[model samples]
Target: MYKSKIKNQKLKNNTYTIAVIGSHSALDVCRGAKDEGFKTLVIVEEGRDKTYADYFKSRGPSTSSGPTGCVDEVLYVDKFKDVLSVKIQNELKKRNCIFIPHRSFEVYVADYDAIEKDFKIPIFGNKFLLRSEERTEKVNQYDILKKAGIKYPKIFKLPKDIDRLVIVKVPEKARSFERAFFIADSHNSYKHESETLIKEGKITKRDLEICGKARGVWTKYMAQKRVFDTGLLSPTEQAELCQVVKNKVPDLEDLIQEYVDKYLY
Candidate 1:
């Protein structure tokens, strides 16, 4: 049986207390709380490095590894609610402490809220509201683009909608060019590159899949064609040609107008 803080006079047995769950980033919050004279503990998934424990102890309270590190005491438990068992709850009650879960693991929100209500301890931050705001922001970006009439490539919900030569991607993974491909042209080029690399045994099929998955969304080459040139190029002749094309392509103005509306609104 682990003794509660009530037995420790230095703690005053009435100090503010918190438990951070899931992420290493919570160490910052734990250190801040300790500076404010709060009893802080951190919980993480098991088998994680104990570096945070050493860091937190050096700053404030003595640290121990529970799952992730940065804890005052370590306990190996899988579920967050396991910390609310009779033994643990009794320890908490004796210490006059509250438990606060980290915001990064949105999965624990409901459990944290339930524990807060049951134990009459405050759970810091509105996880539900924050998640709602994040979801709304993602949907609103698409809505704004649509309202401004920006020409986004068509989105496909099903694999069947993808052409045999088309590319498929996950939206969150679509940030970098290294993850992207040119579809038929890109895939064929990749196959050639892969064969050369395979002879050297440098890259694997798994690597290629990971690269493709990271790209998340794909666009056809035809979809990326520019209708007009900006005409600001140097060397006189090229600039003159670009200006002539710009004059002829009225649709270019409409595209720029759409971008201004979407971004500058």
Candidate 2:
């Protein structure tokens, strides 16, 4: 059963409304909401409406896909912030819609400082803890999880010794989102990763030497990392990811290493 977060207003239709930006994927939030009986309203980038529609068209219930794809409606816009425009407001009003912002969309929304803005429609979830892209005084997502007593992987500046569980990541402020790779247990492995990251221009040797400002204060470079996208790893990179996952399950042992060696190496 679909539990809609659109509150107060009793929309007489069987259709509950949800708004989302279409990200490229077969299984995504819009598809889920649409399957769960909500009339999904997609807000897509100008050229991407077709791309998203096509992707959705490849997979839809009962009738197959296309303009009538998976979602109930698709709205093209110049930018996500334009979601606050009167044009959007009119559309939103028609459905008494629930604005459902995904993580990527919410980042842009937060940049525009768009609060619900008197549209009088309910949002379909808990309040968004807006992330500050600003480097200074920004609340690191990892810190919040830590404060909540969540267990997370070790995070710290590159050190003489790397953690048994490790990843090479870009510092938070850059948001370039340098890829994460397992920092293998051996010192040679750590050095190899450093060289690889430097080669890929993901980080500099200097970045490892000096994280954040030299004010003697520990910065977010020393903070926990958000989850890495293991699926994004290519064959050459999957061995590192395999190593990371294998560390969490030691019993699998040589079987994991053999698979990575045979396929990913």
Candidate 3:
């Protein structure tokens, strides 16, 4: 049903546009496309168009001097999911747009089947990769990482098997996209924190039990007490680690506190 560049003669004109949902890495995608001298389009929801329509909007296609901003055009829709509508798809095809997927696009669109089979736009990345972002998906990021032989945190099959400090990663009850992370040194602490989080409405008990044999199955990393670029500890572990370094580096705790305040909240 969808006519790609190979099938459409209009797309062979060489005037291609880069298009993306107006969230997550939209600015980065638009900026990169603009750098390469291509027009960039951002599809935004009603209340979320300001960033693309005003802040980073370009003056014109190109000027005597140069382009002003990254976002060349902004198409406002009632919702991000509306981008899958026939009207939007037709408009994108007319522009010869290569749609780029991001975290926000996958989350807001919320329909993997439509993205794969219904929406007819030429996607820049593999649409199947979008499903992998969800932890519930059969073939997820963890599966991909394992297949690639990439070293990640070891998952404990059972809570009792946890011999070292490990972080428990689970989806938040209210927000499935966000993870509720906590660190535990043993089964007792793990159970305690899990109960506490359940009481606090941070996570669902069913998800805690079903996600991995042990709730820590998702992300149970050994706390080697060293900072590495590969893995970052939970906020709780970071605070605890900062306390140990506070005595040696008097200002370290303050800096860590500043970082947590600025970013973690």
CA RMSD for every model? 18.4, 10.1, 10.8
- For candidate 1, the per-residue lDDT at 62 reads 44
lDDT of 3 by residue, 1-265 (tens): 4456334534442388999999977887887677656788999888889999999998754657565789988888898999989999888988889998878888888889888888788887578788877766777887888899988877777777777767777878999866777766788978997999999999999988876653225355543433322323644365222122212111335446756986899
Off by over 4 Å in 1: 1-14, 22-24, 52-55, 58-71, 81-91, 108-120, 127-265
Top TM-score prediction, candidate number: 3
Instruction: Report residue 248 deviation for candidate 2 (angstroms).
Output: 15
For candidate 2, write residues 54-154 as lDDT tens digits. 65543444555343456667777888767777888787878767776555565545442455443345665434454433222346565676699986555
Ranking by TM-score: 3, 2, 1
* Model 1 residue 135 distance off true place after TM-score fit, in angstroms: 1.8
lDDT of 2 at 18: 72
Choose 1 or 2, whichever is better by TM-score. 2
lDDT of each: 0.46, 0.53, 0.75
Best by lDDT: 3
lDDT of 2 at 117: 44
Candidate 3 has its poorest 10 consecutive residues by lDDT at: 241-250
Of candidates 2 and 1, the better by lDDT:
2
In model 3, pairs of residues that clash are none
